[model samples]
Target chain A: MKSNEPSFYEEVRVNGISRSDFLKFCTTMAAFMGLEASGVGQIVKALESKPRLPVIWFHFQECTCCSESFIRASHPIVASIVLDKISLDYQETLMAASGVQAEEAYKTVMQKFPGEYIVMVEGSIPTENEAYCCIGGRSALQILEEAVANCKAVVAWGNCASAGCVQAARPNPTGAQPVHKVISGKPVINVQGCPPIADVMAGVVVHLLTFDRIPQLDELGRPKAFYSRRVHDTCYRRANFDAGLFVESFDDEGAKRGYCLYKMGCKGPVTYNSCGIIKWNDGISYPIQSGHPCIGCSEAGFWDNGPFYQHLPSIAGFGIETTADKIGLGLGIATAVGVAGHAIVTNVRKHKEITNTPETVAEPETKKV
Target chain B: MRSRTNPMREVHVWELPVRLYHWVNALCITGLCITGYIIGNPPALMNGTEAYFNYWFGTIRFIHFLSAFLFFFNFLFRIYWGFAGNEFAKWTNFIPLKRSQWKEIMDVIKVDILQVTHKKIDSIGHNSLASVIYFITFLIFLLQCLTGFGMYSAMSNSFLPKLFAWIVPLLGGDIHARQLHHILMWAFILFAIVHVYLVFYHDYIERRGITSSMIGGWKFIEEDVYERHETESKEKAEK
Candidate 1:
């Protein structure tokens, strides 16, 4: 934020933070990823070799907390690598330029660099009409669409752009949509959280730079390397899920003990994100880590699923004990015919192999003896 | 021990192809159940870092797909055999709509439930009850294929999705279709349990070669049983 002096991050990295602290941060990042301790070397190499990537950060219909969380990233290099080293060319919240100058800079970088720039959008786009959200007399949606046209890769900064966030919830009068809806051709990486973890955002950029292609993505277009599993899958609270120890009320003792929030309408089982595994704020905590339920903001249309505090009767794939009927008509289907069909096909195949000799036919003239 | 008291039945009751289909179907059904449970309820951590027992998922999937192709083609051949095979396995053998044959089913069910002893023997092609079960299992098998492909279509993103797109709306959409597919999996389990039990009950307990027929193609059909079926026919009532 201070344009003149060396920032707090630079001050610490150069003179204050010892080599152990620097190595500790690198090792901490690698460990948070469930990787071996030796992976810290890869991170150390990139930071030591590469000066900083140029970033064109855009803001639209959002609270701007993505930028805020990023600055406060638990690791000091997160901000140093992103904000200082990368030379953030233009950002509404953090840059020195303003008014016509900032808009002009944004356009110039996208045009001059063309396929070399990483476009970062931090909010949902209102499709109903640009009138609802206007920046410099242009709609937020219009700015995002134009900016991404020539960009190399796009990072949807938070749930607002990754999924439509609350702005695009059911009966969304503004007709809001996430960045993916308006984007095509170019690869878009959704770093989804209410405000994504700082290092996760940093890791994505580093990954793009370290390997010239974007990370693999899941069906939802969130990075598969990050969002490959449900928060429930890797949660320390999994024992409670199998044991059925659930939080009946927000203030109950169970919640304090950090019991599973599934029964209290936590969509962690169905919603895939890295919050449980890569706890936010330098792996210090996530929403579930802080004793609150995941609202499933990363998933599309999670807002329409129902009240966040009221659990659905049952998730469709949950065994017969939690069959769909128990949850009423919220969106679970346990159609007996569908699963039976899969099983029958599986059975038929197994039967054939057992009957058929998959054993290699002995050569007509050869003898092993 | 008692050689003369129990006379041996002569000849095989099942054709080779038929026996192969039977055994293939049995093995595939078992494999399907194992993999189906795995995909349905993914493995949990037993040890700290051990991955799930998921290697079978791929193997089981390949096996399941191949077996389905085999079973379906075998079904086509079985239908053809009904028209062209030996008299014991002919199309005319399973016409349960005939009247005294219907009476035979009522008496058979009563005899089965009560464990009643009957001195009269029946023709080997299939008794009325056996014919009905054969038809039911065939329909169940058909349904299993439909539901199986429907769920696989959810992931395969193949022609099935386009062909059965109508099923998605009928069942309430992709997720619901997947759910419906899961719930119906148990119906197959129940059907399989009953099928295996009845086969073993007849073969082991009743001393009938019902289980062996799919392998041997010939039951010990006494001449007296054939004579009884032919003479007892009441088709003239329709004339």
Candidate 2:
């Protein structure tokens, strides 16, 4: 720890936040991380003693939704204390420094806190061309490589950094790839979502700060605390899905009844996220709650999964006949027609042979007689 | 000079275990395909009933999963029977390791496909080409199991289905794995169609009672053909 740097507790105290509110913030973060009551104490102790963790947030081929979501953490303590207390050394979107000055600050942070700082990447990197995304005349790839070179751990902020979001969808013109693909040898915590829940982002930071290591991640590198279950599993309307009652269309009677959106092409069955448990925009409502089906923004390659309004995707290489059932029906009809033709040929051949056999037999019999 | 007429003789071809496995497998596949298709494209049955009043969709998924387990077990049993059953049902028939087996495939293709010849294939069991196709079908069955159970793991809390969880990520995600699984269901349906047609065709042309053989566990082969097969088996055993 640096001798002169103030700890997170001191920063909170200096910012006019009461000790009780700061403790409450810790408790909320612990609960969001799916931790037991004991976890709150650990977070408190870590925040009080440890020096503020240095973070460098980078932006590349992204929409800055992650930054927007982060500032709107809902809990006032999170936006005011936790985020402010974190010694955020360099953030392109949030920081006031720009041009040569911003580049200088980024470089200074890398040198001053080498191997001690955290790197939170907010978007994907374009490997197809360096010109696709650049800042300060440096390519995104170059800046990302430099930022992640000596970081303690890398946090891939949203779906863009986790799974290459829309920019990396089918026919990707930029050849954009996720953060994990570009960086290696460091623990990359993928916070998956088009724009991950603000609390989830705070919860991840809390987990890292409290445990001094990355949380348990699933096979796709998403935190297990939030990504362990599918959105459908925890949905409030799951009973409706099981009941076979579904909203047929946006303006239908079923839509007014708030039925399950499964038939409306909800990707909740496949998407893994905490949207159902922690609703968006301060737990007010999620996509399904507001009469919109989940687009599966958290999942990888969701853009290519198919149309948002259709449940089943058309099979990719099947030309005009896209759906699996359509192709199957076509194949079935072709086989039936082929079989009938074969059967007709077999019968014709048999009839000719039977007719010819009697003539040959009569000729042999006459010769013998 | 050969005999003027060759008498047909009954050969015990399909063992009891083989016959049971066949019927059970057929039933399981039918159940799985029907339930699986419904899961993929569920019909919208809108009723004013409360959510708790309807458990039909849940039951349909349960049936799909139940048939999947049965299908998986039936497939495993057939693989075991391939080793334990008669020479005609042996694993050797499915794998074209021998030059004679390859030649048999070419010969059958000539007769069945090219239609250049009307000569009959002399095997008393499944023809060589059909065995190869079955082998491929078995591979597809394995893929179906991995993907089906892989998706099931997300909904299930048991240890068995969780074992196949790795397949979901390996195939890209839940949706891709599901897409592959659904496409292969159609493969099974197509295989069934061709298989049934060939069985009927072979029964009519050869008068071998091929269709009834699966049920009765016997095939009627010409005496000379059966004798030749016996001699060939003995020679192979000796070698």
Candidate 3:
């Protein structure tokens, strides 16, 4: 696949994209990466000179939603140029080669590229048993470790590969783990979402190709350009949250009035993502804009955070979904009852003590020696 | 029947600063609990006016944060006073170092929990067992402050709350820190109920003005108990 390939700029030109259109793509990529206008020229120069980056995308215990999101990206250049430009050596879902031929291509890329290729992980790796999710007689964990041994960087594609999503939720039977937990020593960039926004995925790739470095990341290893602010911080309905106008239920008047969904269990306040700003489907609308609350899918252990419709999560340790109100009210009632019973006994005991004591004659007040 | 008199001596226990801290902290805890509850589970207020005019939730959060500051500063004052104030308020009194203090603690448990009314254990300051409980409560108070400030750090541009931003990540995340903060409020509420009940119960049994001591800083001790306290203080001073 890598034999005699032209550079990204040449490939785009061959695909009928004009030089001006390619420059516009570079500017959009720079802006998406939160870079200054000067970065656009640098991106153009990099794409014009450097060959396409060789990427080996791996699939594990996942639904392939990340690949679906990436292919369905709204930009024409994203689908036609960037995806095609990257010499994606081996992807089980997207590539035409399979069986011995696919394995041969993967080995060839690993040998030829060595430390230059990027390893993109699309889902969590199940370590409990190799049979849980195996590809070509090898476990996901084994393949992931082998794939990233000498790669330049690792990109965790979505929540599954970054935070172990639903497969690693409470009572996880497969013992699934995220990519970073499995591979160390390499720079692991997490594009975290249930399925991260398509444009965001494209932007990360563009930034990596142009700068020849991983984008600046937050404490969670997510690209800071996309995850720096929480959903609540930039929400259009934030004014309603501050004003205390909350939707009591899904079909109430507050819902019709476009009140905040906080009371209906919106996780926007705790979730960090670019959905509120970048939006989805070519900046059409996001989930919150469509009147549904954020489920905090980008966060760690979101599946175990509790029901999506409840406002506050139940106390975590209790086996059932027991709320703070139930516990507090129960304890308060018990204490009141105990106090009332104890008061009765104390009064009775005091009455008995008073009755048992005999009267004595009082002496004139005098100072003790 | 012959009549006799038992003379009692009055001793000052709590200082002005300590008493002031006690009441102000009580008020702050009450305010914090109420406002924190509202913040966590906000009610759906009827929308009659413009959204700008309806700042009830904002006001609730402001009150919670204000009470948090008062709670934090009052706790700091108490810690300082434990080092600089009277013997009863000193840090040494809280630590169960002496054999006598340990014995008094057991005796207090026997009388209070076991309901053995015949035992008469007397001390001018806080009982050893009560001091230990207060010490633990102080630690919980510090935890509440840390988690509270950690949650505020994200919203606040101020320097003080920002100092605790590390706590959120350390405790797993903001939601975990919030759970801890909320649970500790219940701990304080439970402590208050037991504390007030025991204070009144001891006042009835000991007749030492236990409840009133916090108000006027005076405790009525028997003559024998006063002599013993005087000799102990003199020995401490000599040492």
Candidate 4:
């Protein structure tokens, strides 16, 4: 508590990350924040003076993969500083604290640093009589509401906390709700994704410590710095999208070649967030990069989008036939006829039903008729 | 120019070109609505499944596109006419900066709701009051084109669709673009219904057969009304 990470920083040695690598990591983070090159100095000052903010990350009603993903931030130094050395105050998922003591650590931090603490809530709140989800005999929603009430600002860890992920889907019996819904009168920056890339989470925290406030949020209350552009806008398979080449199946050659997944229910066209750019596994690969269609995990309600493997009804304006490329030329012939046939048969049937009264069975010609 | 033809003086009620364009847009838009609705969910065939009836779509689409093309070109002419046509067709003719128009718009609303006539100027070439309605029609037509072509853009070889991709962003996404397209079609339909009713209301109540001016190209302005064409006398006003 009394300033000692510096001496620890001096003694600590990762397998290969040089001092230069750590500084380079900080500078990269500063840049992601849209900070001036000079802002790197502020990051250095905070890292030197603050002894790493004590982050008490709470996980409930989530996959816990957000924590798993954060520690694996590709860059050894980023993972080292934020996950290893960042003096995690108490994490329900990975902390040494147990029972009341574990819960007490978070309470202590809230009381000691009312205006300066960070509350990162991962997963949605269950409101159904609190029976759906209970942590330590209390509802997760009650815990979240209390924690958020005292903190400076809240960071909704992933799509679960931000947009009420799968648990909040249609007919969500748990009554799961996102953090933003319960915590009003507070700044809640939603870092949306199924389990967002580790660096993106670190980047948000770095910006918070450096800027002393949350980064700019778009209309969805998501950080504009991250969720601004769409995945399709920057996807490597974009050329294939334009050229109309697409993967028809998981085992198909087009999939092996990594063509666009538009036909495969990739929600990239409608979804706006960073995935194609800040890919997972240290920018090594993302879902799209790994030859899997993007299920749009970063968006609000991806789970209810049905099975990830099955493509949706063709996004009308976007092409529908993702896996139907076997008889590519025939698709045009087939769909065109389908369109024409649908309209004509419909109209003709309507016309005939109105006019084709059988002469014998039809009402006898009345004087009124 | 009240001495010539004051808007407040209620001279010529509707100008030829502007009025004609308004009515034509209304009629075509109504046609677009009825046909579009039928196209979206066609009637069941009385004939067996194999019986072909493909031309209905072709015919409706052709009618829609042709009418749309006429409306769009008519818009182009109006834009040019806004600069080069007669005094009423000029850009000044389309302005509505009158303090009373805004003040009376509420009165217009009240009167409309109560089925009473509010104090309003008889305008020629769109009254300061009616000009706002025309401008609204103008804006809707533009939106209809953008939305219409955006729907058509999903097809293979349409030019307007390619040129106007901005509609996708306005819709927040393509996943529900058809839903949006369908919704906007109904909007234009509602607009046309109100538009026709208003035109008829003005014609019948105001004693101005303004609906025919679009077809006939001349309003039967009352004599001594100082209709911008001061050349016409009472004797000629009747003629």
Scored by TM-score, the top model is 2
lDDT of 3: 0.82
Residue-pair clashes per candidate: 30, 0, 0, 6
Kindly give the stretch of ten consecutive residues in candidate 4 chain B with the minimal lDDT sum.
B45-54
lDDT of 3 at A31: 79
Error of 1 at B34 (Å): 17
lDDT of 2 by residue, B1-239 (tens): 42223367999999998999889889989898898888877787746667878988899999888888988888998999899888888999999999988998998887665555655578888889989998999999999999999999998889889999999988878888878888899998988888899888777766678999999998889777888888988998999
Instruction: Give per-residue CA lDDT, model 4, range A1-369, as digits (tens).
Output: 446555223423443556687678778787666678898888766655565555667887888878888888867766665445433567877776789898798888887778778888788888876767788998887787788787888889999999789898877888888888877988999998888878788889878766777889876777888876778777887766544456666787767767667667677755666787777787888878888778878877677653565544222233443322223324545554554564454344323222333331132222211
- DockQ by candidate, in order: 0.04, 0.46, 0.36, 0.04
Ranked by TM-score from best down, the candidates are: 2, 3, 4, 1
User: What does candidate 3's lDDT look like per residue over A1-369, in tens digits?
Assistant: 354768888888888989988888788778777889899999999888888888898889899998888777766788764357543578888777899988887888899989999998899988777689888898888888898998999999999999899999978899888998888999999999989988899889988888999999976789999887788888998988889888888888888888889888898887888888888888898888999999888887878776777665786686566766667767767776776676666665444332323221112211221
Instruction: Name the top DockQ candidate.
Output: 2
Model 1 local distance difference test score:
0.63
TM of chain B vs. native, candidate 2: 0.95
Chain A TM-scores, candidates in order: 0.76, 0.92, 0.90, 0.79
Candidate 1: segments with Cα more than 4 A from true spot: A1-20, A32-39, A85-87, A247-259, A310-323, A326-369, B1-239
- Which lDDT tens digits does candidate 2 get at residues A57-150? 8889999998888888867766754357533567887677788888787788789989988898999999989799998888999989988899
iRMSD value for model 4: 19.9
Residues B122-204, model 3: lDDT tens digits: 67888899988998899999899999998888778899998998897677556667778877877787787778887877776
- Cα lDDT tens digits, model 1, B134-175, are 777677666666656654444455764345434533442233
